[model samples]
Target chain A: MFDNPERTNLEQLGEFGLIDHITKAVELKEPSTVKGIGDDAAVLDFSGKKMLVSTDLLLEGIHFDLRYVPLKHLGYKAVQVNLSDIYAMNGIASQITFSIGLSSKFPLEAVEEIYAGALLACQKYGVDLVGGDTSASVQGLVISVTSIGHADGEAVVYRSGAQVGDLICVSGDLGGAYVGLQLLEREKRIFLENPNIQPDLEGKDYIVERQLKPEARKDVVELLARLGIKPTAMIDISDGLASEILHICRASGKGCKLYEDKIPIDPMTYETAREFGIDPTVCALNGGEDYELLFTIRQADYEQVKGQPDISVIGHVTDADGGYELISKSGNVHPITAQGWNAFTSR
Target chain B: MFDNPERTNLEQLGEFGLIDHITKAVELKEPSTVKGIGDDAAVLDFSGKKMLVSTDLLLEGIHFDLRYVPLKHLGYKAVQVNLSDIYAMNGIASQITFSIGLSSKFPLEAVEEIYAGALLACQKYGVDLVGGDTSASVQGLVISVTSIGHADGEAVVYRSGAQVGDLICVSGDLGGAYVGLQLLEREKRIFLENPNIQPDLEGKDYIVERQLKPEARKDVVELLARLGIKPTAMIDISDGLASEILHICRASGKGCKLYEDKIPIDPMTYETAREFGIDPTVCALNGGEDYELLFTIRQADYEQVKGQPDISVIGHVTDADGGYELISKSGNVHPITAQGWNAFTSR
Candidate 1:
């Protein structure tokens, strides 16, 4: 509890005072904490495990639409996505620091709800909520999460390791989240246009759920560890399979050849895409927010994952001379293009 | 260079496409990087040293005046402040992850400048610019930095370790940054009134720089180490001294007695405070952003720091019943109050 003797002001005390005031109460619990408050960063000892680190931000209106987007899910998703980054690095998150910028619209309950979600996520993931910051925004809510993780030194995979001829694979199907978003937007339009319309969402449960309550592929990471196969390269299917593959291609100094027939799309996702008059494969290719694992493995290790139910091999890496191309079932080869979200993008 | 053959729209490609496009060109240099780009976070080898971790966020109007504040300093300070936190933890930084919410007002160069500042700080701190996320913000620029560092097992300090009668010490001086801020605001007002009058900033270099570029007290940690002394507890002076002390009192479950005369104020800072019609002591006590180190040391280690020029021993810890008190120059004791910046106090 704070003692408000004279009703002190933050501006009068300034930013430094606010930071010191808030942080001064934190205490170190372990000897591994060599330094805590005066240096460039906090230092720690994690025995011999590899270090993991990642950061992500949630912007109002862009990443989330506050109307139906609960504050709890927002907080949970902020931490989860950052932790997902650590998982993408093949690491187990141990600590996280979260930062938030909220407008006057936020009440005490709103902030607490956000923390509730974050705390719930921490408990679910077995990670500690280490530290964070909160501030007032001019107009919207913004949350940024940074997670620290630990992994075995030998078990980590990276996007740059996709050698020529490495088998490109993905965990589960994609495009469900995108289709789900489409369904939500459609419902949003109907609700906004006329309040009398009973939302026709009874049949689109899977797609809508995928859009609203997306889960990080934490299960896949544990499953991979248990299955005893480390991918040569890996990335999360956040934007789409095509875009993520290009990331691997450029990073590994190689090219990718993806099979349209092999691209996995959920039945619900396929149906929703057709209903929206979009190709299900295209939705899987370029749709965002899948949060699935896309990875490359050496051909020799295909035997390790041959009949796994959750995994599918969609393509193979090749030398750069072959170019970044997508092979369609009808023998059509199309060059991939860049079309991910860009802030500077005028459109 | 990107081959911008077909100018695909970002909204069409969506968030996933953007992530892939942005990450496509990254080639990680460290072999210690076990996995990257796909998981919850990036994984790096521990490499035998203790680690450090810190996170900080910079909001647009609250943290900086964009009219004069350059993007590079914003980026640099964002990283620097977090690094400073690690330093406060008595650790050496190794890795950092950044997440940014950029407004449409900024062009690519603005982002580059911010990163340039971040890069400079990384080079200075010997840390890797490992991973980050950049996304659109409807409001203003938001930069959040999460830094990791390593600390020796023996030298770590926490706020909860203060004992009854440990000497309170602070590195460097305070109030200069606050005074400097007053000057900046005053000048800003003048400039807004009429763009003709130049800023009357003669002989005001120290305070202005203090506001513009406050360095973290990294040297104090090294000096203390060299003096063969370990602080019982430590925190950086991001907030004011009163708030920081209150934090120590709450965390350590103890009270403290501070001497008004013992508080450190640089001569320039003192003069500036007076010029602004502020009590220099109050300014020093309540002003924030000094980025100095506030710590406590045992009585036995008194001789080790007694002769240090930059350090000041201001008070001592006491039992909970003693209560937090400050002895004035007139030999009058006043019970300490926990009053500092409150973001909601004004709103």
Candidate 2:
């Protein structure tokens, strides 16, 4: 989208040349990275630490819309989403492999912007870009990212470790990303209908940024460790709070009672949902791509997290016989069903 | 192209339902894998071994033609290509992450076939399917595989360690995969031209299989260890022998003399190339996707591999001043240039 006349065609450079160009600016800073980009595989040494591996795939029309998403933000968000999985496991991501496929319509500069954003995220998160595959696609752009991280065996968290009486907690706010997406989609529709109009996103920067550039909750994991509280279980909220909590309950063979009022919704998100005739609580429960951390800790450790500004106690784990329920602000108990966003169905 | 009329629509299963259905039969047999699937990330323990990570992406139309490629074979070959990268580094692949994107046209049965083939490869290679991401694409199918392997720090081989005077060796034969592709394209063209005509593919099974179901050289890596011979340098022959050897020379800052007469071409591959009015030697030099191992060894160990039927010593490393050269069968020397298959250029 830049107004640059000089554009290099990818056909002239070929695949290997493109790989060399993309990797030329990469600097490996991870101590565990023995080798990065140039060999058949990148060599890494975890040095007796447990390894965590996660992958994410983003497609053209399914996972994103290029009309509203910048290539740089797309690249940055791709890396962040994969790293979020590692953070969900209470691990520090160290290296990542990013593979992308694009049609000839993409110029060399566009590809550079994607890598620039990806590298920026890596630099900020202190991860090394190790190895990846690049190819020409038949249609739209496709991106796949795999992140590798490490943690001590005992320090690693699992979603199946929540026990009865564990306090259910969440970090940051929920529903902002989903609300931000709604705002962008509306603006896109308006712009499409009237080419002379500009998107009015001035006052919605906070919610819009949440959708465009959500960060993995690495700081939350760090905070929990700093407080000397190992979460009994943890998961990143990629598919809404209700769906993720249900995942924990299924995996841990436990039930949870979530308080609708305690589910943190940013004022912007709440107001936006209300303006759109959507219930704010429903937005918090069913919206996706928040990238916040949902975790559980023992009752004794609740005191350590109670005063944390970013952390909010939303619920508590219970016996499986209790069934999953949400207590509304009106003191009405409703059965929780997973109406999580499904990309396939949504498409 | 399945015979069953019953088809389960992907939209009906949703994303998580599809994931659960696909991974229902995955059995984890790797001791290094602590968690497989059903989590935000897979946990692995490499103990004291160094890890090797590699990734590959295969897009429809560019990488394969659905008219000739079976879904099962596509899945199998995709994993094999990625694992081959790990083997090229002289490491044993222990885990793999398989991500895929497809349109709504695909049924659950079709997706199941893809996974069946992938899991079959994992079973055969003793590798575990640790984690992956699945999504819906706007167009064609997309497959991305990442392989994780391990080796002792001192035991890993790189493409940059070849020294002058070391002999260049290649495992198995070259040019078969390329020739096989040519045969399949011919058959496809003929079938497209005449609806009633049955294309002739008889007695071409060897080359055809080489193209459709090539296996990674894991056995060759094991054989080398068993023979007590550590390669000075090694790389897989993915982009033809000439291009791969040039990679070694460039990485090592050395030149090489590749003898055309010493290059091994399967008899079927030679006949197929001649049948297509192509030079067999050129096929061996410039053909891609053979998945054979190319390596260098100390001259002292030449006697040990001299009688090996599968290994061929085709050249020797030389000083950079000597330049990259190919000695013809007529004893005339020609400077070697890389004409390796470039997917982007070819498209």
Candidate 3:
């Protein structure tokens, strides 16, 4: 996607020089930030709050395909994925360390494009770009991000906190990102077969954007706090709704009953799944990378979030012997299974 | 190097199962770690202390050659390199996130070997293995580590605090790791040339250990704190002594006069460099990956460190106009340059 003719060779600027060029404009905005960018390590002082940290590594072929993914969007998505982990804990992300391994094929402008996307995400999330390491890769690009966040000790949520009778809720719609991926992959194959024909993604803006630049649910955390409602358990939906719900069930030693009709699926996503010969319910259950918040709250707090516009109450926690099940719209119950993305398998 | 006859395929156990298998034995030793593995994010409470964070990415074939390097050693070195950055800031590393991307060729036992070494390092350094991401790579191994550390606000040091006439000092010996790398490369070539012949690496224990498993100088930070002596400026020597000194000079806006005779070099390193037909002083100057702490202390406080065993007084700082210079043992002055590892360049 990088067709800039005036590309500068990366070798012209050494590693230290490249770091200086990219981070020269960094301005730390957090009062807790004591040092950033130019130091051996970023320094921060968060006295009363508990610290939260999460890291993710994205490989070129396994985690992403550059043939259809833009470098800038890849950078933005990488940061969002890590920040999603922090937000899942009901914490406020404050800083991130972004490290990348680039092959010789990448030019200085390509790296700049990626950094611009990363910086843009940081700006939107109010996170400071702290410290990172840059190195050369043998073949393809590798992106690693570590997000640091903080929350009051009492406010932090864990996956093992869910209790029986809690209401299961999710923010925003699901299956959109998976449908977007299918469209992009189909377009990529067509373009490779015939370079002259343009991709037919004319009216698929919402799904495509959902796949390319999905946003973390930082606003959901803020909204819940504003409503004086705290989730008993929470997790970000990166590995499908089924997998995340199972994570909570396994951790909390409880079972769940999910209502299929209550699962929110965007119209575009449903239509696209039909076109791809896939079930919309299956897509919503197993499609990953939605970046939405899946959580549970006490039954007493149901009135606080009952009519929220973006929040959907999909199910409720049950006793361990009830087992994990999905009650279909037609009144049939099916056992829930986690068939989320398993990178080790070639499926 | 993994030649087990009955190797277990990684696909047999999915990503979550693999993570559980590898980290099941991890015991949290730090009181600050409120939560560790098996969570969306690790939680820590470093109350009343300034937090330091750093990250590093290491790729196969680019950062290391698996043909000569052991997987366990690679894992150990990756964690050590990141911890070195924390110690450079005069902090105590307490927690780390270790993420890796493995290809299909690697068996489950191979990954366990790497984690074993990583756990060993964590046990030795009193750092907790908190959380990480594991995925599959298309080709080679990819390792990324993020180290979290803490120090009292008053005890933290920075690279930009050096003053004119400050004494430049470095801990431990230099050039050993570089020479050790040379020895390993020579043996690899010899083995490649003759399949049936055994390569030789006799009586090179110290230098080889330095290269294969370099330790972070956490002890130096503790020693300085115990002596009630804080460095005016400090940095870890990862990109060679010359590069690190220049970093201090550039950040502090000062010049330095490094004495070639005062640069500490192990006797085995000196002999090995001569045997390889290389200049010992040049190796000491530009050879990287030593993992030693280089710092500057005020002249008035020099008395505290003058009689220390492993520390050496290499030079003194000067006004910016004096420029960075190295006075050779033969009385000739030469400008210092950073010929450190530039990943983009083949050299």
Candidate 4:
């Protein structure tokens, strides 16, 4: 995906030259963006509104394997993940600063491809590319994106607001990204073993795409606003469902009762998990990188969200004294354990 | 400086636990910071002012050698450099997001020391540590800091506002950081050759400190404001003075004439440069990481700043056709060339 006919060495361009080259075509779309690329810092005006800020760092081997992950998709996913945090706060992302520490092994064309993917995401989300720093690294590519957003003071949501009667809701299906990762890793190993074979990704487009280029749930935030429903507490499902649920519960000083049967899993995700000899429910509970919104709403607002096509009412909030439990499909209860991604040990 | 008796593996704490431990003492001081460190994203209110945003990526080997650099000073310098960009725009920085990608070599205590230094900087500057990501790196440590600040619409400065007759001025002294780096590198080489030999850093405290913990000139920004002198064009001298001058000249469609003798160089820096068999003028011209403000003021405002103790009037801006030149003390004029730190090619 990153093959280019004419490759220019990065050293020939230097830092300033490379910056001028990459930002030459940048077009700012937000009126609030008073100043963009060239200045020491990007100037913005968010008068009368509250601002939201979040940052995420992605390392080459730890967060991704460049042998399988395309630079374009990596760039796009980096921005999407940071934007997911903003959407989790019920805010609209307005600007982003995309900085990279790239090694010389990457040519100018590779960096340009990464920027192309980043700009595409900004175009799609209406977020302005403000300012960033590009420095040479000794190892592989390192991407750090900081997203800025704005929202009305009263409309912003936090994870510590859920009440005992709040309904635990989630947007879109779960576990597809994890299943997709397994497919990619399996194919990568197979390809390494036998170079003659192509990747067996023919019929797994949905799951594969879910892993390669996950989208932030901006539509769900808009939908909630249109329906006049505000989540009492919210968080993006980057760490598996179990871990995120625990975070919300701990922050809100409450407990949660999650229903395994109510969790929405796509048919492809379920079949793939079974093929891998893994329980589908376990994947839904522990698999991560869904980029979906997990939120809680007041019981009085249940009527407004129950029938929504994209949202599923999977569980309910409970008192702090009540332990966090997951109701199994067979009418048995199990303690919710966080088996989410631990970067230090797992990778 | 980084000797910790109790060493705990990072894997034992996990990501969330490490973050909680590092940021446990972070006290938010900015009134605009509505919420910090715990939510999906930080919340701030820049209701009546323009916001300035900038990001920088610092890699371990390329930016600093950990063998000689203490983690605490590295963390502090990283924040100082990013804040320098905001101050270069004549903005008062209010918040920052500091993210790090660490390898297994770093223990929990080392990471804590880094955070301690970062928190100290935030406290001194009255900026809040809002939100950031902590991930495991496959190689050396990587830091990414995003600083956010506010400025009045009319008070903010840009690089593209210089005129034909603007006076070029600089804050504090130059070349000390570069000379300090040379001293450190020489000592590092000597120590590696024989472990028994201590570093010969006697009588070089000023230059060594300049390289280890350079301060951002926020005082200059305040001084400019106090004197009611708004710069016509401005940039922080992260790169050499020649490169920064070229940036302003290219952006503003003007040329410049810098007086070599007028450039500020500390006495220790000059003597050290002589000891290293390098010209003091060359060190002042090409040495980077000064973290000083290099700006241009209208000739009419020159009287207000000429006698300032820390500010030096280096030269004057000229028409685009005049070209960028430097006048030597020996009555020789030569075109100024940029030999700044080119990360891709130099290292």
**Alpha carbon lDDT at A25, candidate 4:** 67
Per-residue alpha-carbon lDDT of candidate 2 for residues A1-347, written as tens digits (9 for 90 to 100)? 44456888888999899999999989999999999999999999999999999999889998889989989999999999999999999999999999999987888999999999899999999999999999998779999999999999999999999999999999999998888999999999999999799999989999999999999988998999999999999999998898999999999999999999999889999999888888888877888899999999999998899999999999999999999999999999999999987767744
lDDT of 1 at A314: 92
lDDT per residue for candidate 3 within A135-238, as digits (tens), equals 88886899999999999999999999899999999999999999999999999999999999899998899999999999999999999999999999999999
Q: Model 3 clash pairs? A: none
Give per-residue CA lDDT, model 1, range A1-347, as digits (tens).
11334445444544445446645444444333444443334455778877777788788877889876778887787777777777777767777777777664555457666777877787777766666777777767888888777777787777788899889999888999889888888878998999898778888888876776667778888987887878888888778787788888888899989898998888989987999999998888888788888999889889888788888999999999989998998989999765654554554
RMSD of each: 5.5, 1.1, 1.0, 1.4
What proportion of the true contacts does each candidate reproduce? Answer: 0.63, 0.92, 0.88, 0.91
Best by lDDT: 2
- lDDT, model 4, position B185: 98
Model 1 alpha-carbon drift over 4 Å, by segment: A1-44, B1-41
What DockQ do you compute for every candidate structure? 0.43, 0.86, 0.88, 0.86
Candidate 1 global TM-score? 0.89
The model with the greatest DockQ is 3
lDDT (Cα, tens digit) per residue for candidate 1, span B208-295: 8777767766778789888988888888887789888888888899999999999988899999888889998787788888888889
- Each candidate's clash count: 59, 0, 0, 0
Query: Which residue segments of model 3 deviate by more than 4 Å?
Result: A1-5, B1-3
- Badly placed stretches (over 4 Å) of model 4 are A1-5, B1-5
Interface Cα RMSD for candidate 3?
Answer: 0.8
Tens-digit lDDT track for model 3 on B1-347? 35677988889888988998998969999999999998889999998799999999999988888887888898899899999999999999999999999987899989998898888889999999999999999968999999999999988899999999999999999999999999999999989999787767789989999999999999999999888899999999988999999999999999999999999999999999999999988888889899999999989878999999979999999999999999999999999999888888865
